[model samples]
Target: MRREQVLVFDADDTLWENNVVFERVIAQFLGWLDHPALGLPERRAVLDEIQAANAVTHGYGSGMLIRSFADCATRLRGRPVTAAETAEIAALAAVLIDHQVELVPGAADTLARLGVRHRLLLLTKGDAEEQRRKIDASGLAPYFQALEIVPEKDDAAYRRLITAYGLDPAESWMIGNSPKSDILPARRAGMNAVFIPHAHTWVLEHGEVDASDPGVLHLGALTELVDHF
Candidate 1:
């Protein structure tokens, strides 16, 4: 049997619905933005491109997403956006603020089962308030021994978590869907990692993973953790 160890989890796509909600809101915005010349795919490309540039400066969350929508519409229309259009775009995100947190299938049960033997820590990065709000809503917060919300989950962030938690890098594992934020960085910090790819993972979090990586394990779903750990 494996030894009891620290398990760090990414909260957004890993635990509950996040980017999917944004995608739904964006779809609604796009429907409203039906352009005379551009097709749906072309319109989506414009928004995606604008978000790639704006995400670095604006950071993340619904507010930044709304900004990207406005910027996209402005660029598409070739004119400064009116207050009405901005308000309509803002309403899309406003509805997003109230979207209920939907946990991944068996997430709560898996956390409960694992918590009995291992320490579980939630290590999600995003707007602090937004992250916390989701945490509060998920009802899975009780499973975590502690939670750390940050702007980004980089290698340094992983290293810092180790220092703060007094975790043994070899004994610890990071669990989540995103390879960029969860798997690779944890491996770099000398911890083992489990990659469970999500279908609708944010474009920014995509990263290639090698199947032969020494300590990285890939799983089909969250419930499968029960058998492994």
Candidate 2:
């Protein structure tokens, strides 16, 4: 007998253009930097270092990114940052948070099709309020049976979600672009995972997926998911 399957989806890069927004914001922030001695690479390195440290306390979101920009600017300048500079960074955060939510090519169509045959859940990691804002704006909420905005996605998180939802791991499928967050953790939690690689995946989310992992499936695009279901 075929088991009833629950399909879980990741919100950010998997369904929409998320990381590119951050990339653009970082570029603009770098352009505003007063320190010309620091090249783009050096500035980015500083930003990444600060963001990583902030992630532990701040988690993830535009707010964390905004704080990172402020911290990076101060560190690079070797002096207190000006109010004008801080405001500029704040404006970048505003742009990021207010940016229109555009779905990845064929994301809506694929979700529509899959939603009809399977119980679909949106499982994403980020600041709850910010994630909710994106979900509300994306117009993809109706397709999901539930929306889970978590602080992090790990094996423990996946296990908790599976248990809370009363989902059979053997009959569940987790789909997303991140190997670290979506693929590895879900697979570790005993669910099947489908990895749809994204061109602009965040650096922190990068991880290797073992080809030999029986629970893992790799696809080239969101549209290809229709063929699987």
Candidate 3:
């Protein structure tokens, strides 16, 4: 019998249009902030800096993002953010949390086809509730054998999943848009990776993809999976 292979997928920009929604919210936040001396580019730079710093301390998700926005606004104003202003920011930020999850085209059909032949797992990093909410809303959760939501994805995290699922690294592949979180870490864990780049992937998730790596597979879209595997 052929050895059973496992395919681990990333949820964000891989399965759905995640970062674009965040971009929309960021645009709204920047417009609302409207710093006296800063243009849109300058304001975005400041917010990105704050988000990078706050991500480690406060973690990811819409809530932490809005918190960073508030902090950025406070810094821009050079004064304590008033409660009224905070409330307004929160109101404007609600769409970030409640926005409908947009699944990538053919994602569900691709996953369904793959799931029939190989075990499928979802490996997404974010706030638990926020990630789960998206998974549920996408109607793609049923395609995965197990859905994993973690604070981060790294070599260690991939190894943990390997051990937990009794997966053989040689027969496993990480599929996603993130070279940083998905491809690199899975390669480090002795597993293969499938890279599907997304145009609007978050800046923080950007990293170098070594196309020379023999274990790496590059594909254009989810529908292309059937021909290769």
Given candidate 2, what's the lDDT at residue 26? Answer: 89
For each candidate, what TM-score against the reference?
0.95, 0.95, 0.96
User: Sorted by lDDT, highest first, which candidate order results?
Assistant: 3, 2, 1
- After the best TM-score superposition of candidate 1, give how far the Cα of residue 168 lies from its true spot, in angstroms: 1.5
Candidate 3 clash figure, as a count: 0
Give all candidate RMSDs, comma-separated.
1.3, 1.5, 1.4
* Candidate 3: segments with Cα more than 4 A from true spot: 1-3
Residue 129, candidate 1: C-alpha displacement in angstroms: 0.7
Expressed as tens digits, the lDDT of each residue in 193-217 for candidate 1 is: 9999999998878998879998998
Every candidate's lDDT: 0.89, 0.90, 0.90
Candidate 2 wrongly placed segments (more than 4 Å): 1-3, 34-36
Give candidate 1 misplaced runs (Cα > 4 Å). Answer: none
- lDDT tens digits by residue: candidate 2, 1-229: 2335799999999988899999999898988885768888888888999999999899999999999999998899887779988887898778887899989999899999888788999999989999999998999999999999999999999999998999999889999999989999899889999999998998888899999988888899989987877
